[model samples]
Target chain A: MTAANGNVRLAARSLAPAVLVMGKGGVGKTTVAAALATLEAETHGLAVLVEFGDGESGRRALGPTHKGVEHVVIHAAEAIQRGATPLFGSATMAKLALGNFAMRPLLKAAPAIRELAMLESVRQIVEARPGVRVVVDMPATGHAVAWLRTAKQGREFLGSGPMFELCDRVARELVAPGRASIIVVTLPERLVLEETLELCESIALDPGLEVARIVVNRVPLPLAQECLVDARALAQGGGALAQPAAALVSLLEARAAASAGAVAALEVFAHGPHAIWQVPLAPVDPSARDVARWLRAEGAA
Target chain B: MKDPRVIVCAGGGGVGKTTTSAALSVALAARGYRTLIVTIDPARRLAGAMGVPITDVVTPVPLPAARGRLWALMPDPRRSMGTFLDFLFADEPEAKARMLTNNLYLGLADAAAGVHELVAMNLVARAATEGDFDVVVIDTAPSRHAIDFVTYPARLAALLGGRTVAWLAGLAQRSGGATATAPRGLLSWGTGHVEHLLARVTGPNLVRDTANLFADLALVRERFVALTRRASELLLGERVAYALVAAPTAAARDDVLFLAARLEKLGRRPRAIVLNRADTQAAPWVRALREGHGVAPSITEVLDVLEQERRTRATAADALAVELRSKLSWAAVVRLPYVEASAPEDIVAALSTELDAHLTALLPDAR
Candidate 1:
């Protein structure tokens, strides 16, 4: 890894036309994507924000800070609601009617429709703000793989249509170099790191999309060296009860150390320059205030 | 108990099946029916959508609702499986306890060994048959093997101890039978391996019991087959309506179509389609901004922004509508607008509008 400021930047024109954020759940993919959007919108003065494939986790996370940026959350049901109108009613009443009539049935009827609909939403946002950057807080590894693979499946099954076109475009966007960067977010854990590497392979990460970086979130820093030594020695001379407690502390320290190693291995796997910023685990669930502060700092950075 | 029936929701993963089950149960309750949704997804996401934490046991509490009660339950499969084993092997509690703690059982059970699907299906069938709620909706696991949970018992009945098997056993057991003196066949070798493995793992009594369980499997299979037919009737019955839940993406649509086609093959078509997170335009009066740089500061930026927003809304709207029109013609198509929160009230409200749309669509002739 290079010094923070030495971070390799994607060439604007040559970069992939999109950015893909890959990670396990709760490793702050949404937070980082939101932060990137915050940075783009505030510092760069670009119209930008993150997009989510399903539900509204991303939108909710970015809601308060979505000032200059547009946070577009897409799903099939939402798309249909936007499409319908009152033939003989007010917009409110018409939406109410159509929301139940035209949209709801459509929502329940198809799974591919939801994904295709979301892609369409992404396309819409991109076309709307061509110059604006889009940070997608993409689905978890398994779901994201399914989402990415949909394009190949579509080309085979759906033949040609708007849906197929959108899938092809998204696939091209994903594969195109410098157009997009796949930032794999993870915590320093054997399972998470292993999964990250596996995800890279499953998603065809190597030699295709440049993995921009790996962000290991919520890592607890080790205690002082003396404290760790004391803890380890005490652990060795322990009674049964004391051993568990001492072992726990040792385990935690080992985990923190291993997290760094995991990051190093990722650097080798990526074969590209990356950044590793240590995020301390929150003491409590983040209130909106905490999120706002974090957002502010990220924006400034 | 006005329309006491169950809606067993099943499908592949990442298809929004969980969300659909949650919303539909809420919708039925909103229409004045006491409803419950039982979810078996490992993520326990249904509770997140409902704004509550789920416990293992049944605990019905009133939600902020539309004059009716809706309850949600999420069962931990490991716990459920343990409880079930305790019940099934009541005579062998010590062995059951050991099995629960053993590494092999842990691996096998966690691998789910297809047992999660079996247990989930069994629970749903049992719950539906033994419920007082106006409706019971089941959200199954995402595996394609999920189908086997509902259909396997009958499928394996022949292998289980059927009457034919009983006759064959009786014929084989005949004293001085020619086969008894004959050389061992492939079937005997396979049974010998099965017997040896069963003895090593579960002991002679358990092996016998398991053999008996297989013998009784014919009964279990018959019961499951009957229950499946009953479930189909209950779901497709006029009082109950099956809705296929999907996102509007190509993959999600294809999954739904796959599920719908499967259901059609089973003669159990869904009654409606609930499409979540439909992309709608910002109100016409809302001011929009441009993204890129341009020198002349032309009106093109303003027009371009408006044009983009219009196109975004139009593209999403047209895509799902065309799918619904072409494919799910018999079903009502309800589209839910995206809300920026996972709060239950927010989801319920958004979903309620979609449900209302479905009702309107279903009653189209009324208009």
Candidate 2:
């Protein structure tokens, strides 16, 4: 794990084939991943960004495609339909339609098995579509663990089988350094930081993947020391609410310190080269254009 | 089975079951019925929705409505397992030890996905059969696992019986004994390990005297049958109404349909569908302001778009309502406006109003 700057430099130069953007749900992983792919496409003129997941959140976030950047949204269910063909080739397309009549009961019988089948189907896509930057908006933490563990499950259940062999190989390739990079997006909050660090540790254990950097979204802007002092004095030198002014200042200072502590904790836990970028919460929902501008200005992507 | 004393809500993960359960329990309790909401998801979502800090212990919390008292508890399978072991062994140390040491027993208990449901069901059964709450509403795991949860004990018992039935029957034939002996070698060793574990956990006399606990298949079969039937009745009874919850998205609507069909197969009928974030036509004035931007070709086109939006909402709501009514003897449609905030108060209040008319008849005093 290089320093955050070094890793970013490495990523910019090498531009790994597969990048998995992962985080706890609702932490702006989708936004950041889309921005990264869009920026890479615009700046260096990449051909396309293949977004994989149930939500197709990246495709939604990135908006319509442009000349340099074409977005291919691969829904897992659709991918499952495609992948099941080679295995269940004799079956009709209707039989393989993800939630169709024939497949529904079998899929429901064992959920873990269904998930494994879907993931392998995904791996098949990754195998076919080479030489492109594919960004997987991986499921949130718990399900991400489940996704990674699918190979282990396959090995256990179908030892020496082709499905098991392929899953194991794909799992090996994914966890390998330089093959894939994992970006852990999180808010600069204590619990989120802890989970992010735990995730990093799990990735570290894999030996194939690297914790690229931590993008801390929705951070509050800093107040200058002089500005705060002036505000304190003005409040103290005031009207009917003057008496409680000192207490209010103390509360505000505590909150400010807590926010600072969150960032510091992330820096400490993120031992590898890690960039801590923050996005100020806009009063109104930020437009995709505005979000892109902020990303570039903040040097997040 | 009309107006059965308990309602078990079952569904898959990430669905709005917890929210539905909390809102329903709050609604029922507000109507002056004592209600308990049970859940298992460790997200502490139910607690957060109910405005309680994360705690495993069950405690009553006052809802904002009049005469309302809703208690919430998450299913702790490990603790439930302990209580179940204690109950099975009659609090005897030897019996507890045998169960603990037995490979098959421990494997079935720990390795099985549906065992959590079994233990939780036991707790639910005890509450419904013993506790005083008029209704025990379960916000089940998502529909994917809901069926398994309700049928687990029966399914597991049947599976085990199938595996051992022939051998047990042969042993009964040979020995002229109603209580068939444990099969020899690996099977006997496994059973002995279980017996020893039970003896150590529950006490030696428990193992010696209660050999029939495992040998007599009838006891296990009887409990499973009773639990399955009771749960099925409570879940599917005419009075027990399942509210299919989904946000207003095409994907969600599809999932709700799939979930409703699955639940119906399991004998749990969905009496209503709540479109959680259903979009209503923006005020005509607001639409007029947008249309007046000089971007539109004609008045007809503007009216057509607005008409389309309104018609879509009407059709979606109507479709869901009709589907539910067709499947269930009683059904209604409830639509809630999409709110930007994810606050509990907003969700609770929104759902409460939608449920107002449907829940009126089911209030405790009505019974």
Candidate 3:
């Protein structure tokens, strides 16, 4: 393994118990979560990859199954059922309450109920399994923020009830240092960079919820400045190669410029406190193993 | 021939659906059709692309060169539910006031995904019917399940119009004034046990507050039903058109197919499948470089890597287009070139120019 790989391995050794990967849609959240889970499992002996929506993303990223890792899809309805059983004092009573047509929709329509149940379910999983590290691939930005804020909203709405207690437990665990950390993934495009900056600012507002890392995915490698100068000279010569050479140079230059701008923006936002990692653009869609390997190489670089 | 009254753009995240929606509206407005583009994305990307601030109010887009006018409505998701409730309870000020301040109602309005989407659509329906516009273009949220929002209004209308809500509201009215007493009736008999179980789990205060909220909502049930019905019709009617936006990645292909299936299940089909950034390869340039000799190795090395990446991306896009064409033969597949601009407005303008050429294919009567 290279020095970068060694550095990534060292960084992977100090992860929190639960890592929530969040970002805008199509920003490689699933890929990062899967790679983190793989790395954590290698060190911890076992890790759980949690998916909130359909389970297809986890399977696609990890290729169905991997050693030392387990994939769990948390559905809100099932989570509500599991969480309410103990509170209702009987499984049958929980089922009856959830099964009623009038009550089911009402509960479903209630704000933060689904989000609270999902978070509570994750808390239960972590408590039930002491040694396994958990990695969650969160949904889009809007829904992810809603899920994070559910605890506070639920507490205010339901002041003193079993649901309130559940919310408090989830909220405490989320804010506990070294218990859960959020990793925000983003791309190097203009709009994506702005959104990433905004997301980091929002995450910073919450006192205890740590922004563990800022990962810039799909960044292109910077080309040598002399190459661009040479290509520009060739373009001015008016040869057949001049046009294609110039096109190639401009494309590369544009991508490199965008990557540089994104990195600079991240640097200003991070201000030497937050960790910023850049993942080079892969030739094709990468799997969990590919990303883990890339992480290692990136760390050494 | 008449233009489609409603145009819905559906796709996965980061595929340029918002840009496409904005461009489409720009193109339509240029053709002398007054258009309003409504975006349900909480990211508020339309404002960036259009270079205008959009709120819940319909704001005019300054398109001085266009033959007709352009407008936009980007409702804040947090406030949409309250705005919708205000509109629903416009006739009864007291009920509206109570419902607005109700804890349960406030909680439901804050983060309910279904309510946010429903209210956004309701706003679209209101704009389409009440505003003076030739066509309404909708930019849906970036998710496979975003299509599900089209069904929410109908489902909610059915739920509220049923006897269950009425009975629950009645129960709340009877319980609020006096001590709880069991009533002997067929509907109440079965629901009484369910209510007891629900109260036990969610707490009695929650049940009472929820029931009271519904009781207030029941005052305008007919108006709610009418609004939802109109929204459903505008979304799912024959005059509505669906445009599926996609990119050239494997994931985008899967997302397009998934969205197509969902639309199909809803008895609808995309009128046009827009392939954004499909033409990324500079083939003539690559061929010329390959034939030329006496080039610097530095330039050659950079060109070689970029050419490979471009070829791979182009090939993937071609393969995706072919597969989608074969699978969804009914929809017209349109390709949009990758714009090299960096600014959001520049990208939107370039895309709008590209879309201007395919208006007829996207909307058959758009000419």
Candidate 3 lDDT tens digits, B279-344: 755556666776688877887787677667767767878888899999999998888866654566
User: Which consecutive 10 residues in model 1 chain B have the weakest lDDT in total?
Assistant: B283-292
lDDT of 2 by residue, A105-179 (tens): 323433454455555654555566676566666656645655666655445434453445555665666544676
Residue A140 alpha-carbon offset, candidate 1, angstroms: 9.0
**CA RMSD of all predictions:** 21.5, 12.2, 3.4
Candidate 1 per-residue C-alpha lDDT over A1-301 given as tens digits, one digit per residue, 9 for 90 to 100: 2232222223222224456677754456676676556545654466455565452555655655566666666655665343222121245643544343212332342244455446555655665667777777776655565555544454444345433455566556544465566767776654456667777776664335556556666554443454445445545654542443343344445545665666676775554232444444442223323443543432224
lDDT head-to-head 1 vs 3, winner: 3
Best by TM-score: 3
Q: What is the lDDT of candidate 3?
A: 0.76
lDDT of prediction 2 = 0.54
Worst 10 contiguous positions by lDDT, candidate 3 chain B: B170-179
lDDT of 1 by residue, B81-181 (tens): 66556444556555555555543233233322334445454555555555567567667666433444445433343344333334223223332233444
Q: How are the candidates ranked when ordered by DockQ, highest leading?
A: 3, 2, 1
Q: Give stretches of model 3 more than 4 Å off.
A: A1-6, A206-208, A231-253, A268-274, B1-4, B27-35, B57-71, B114-135, B166-177, B186-193, B280-300
Between candidates 2 and 3, name the one with more favorable lDDT: 3
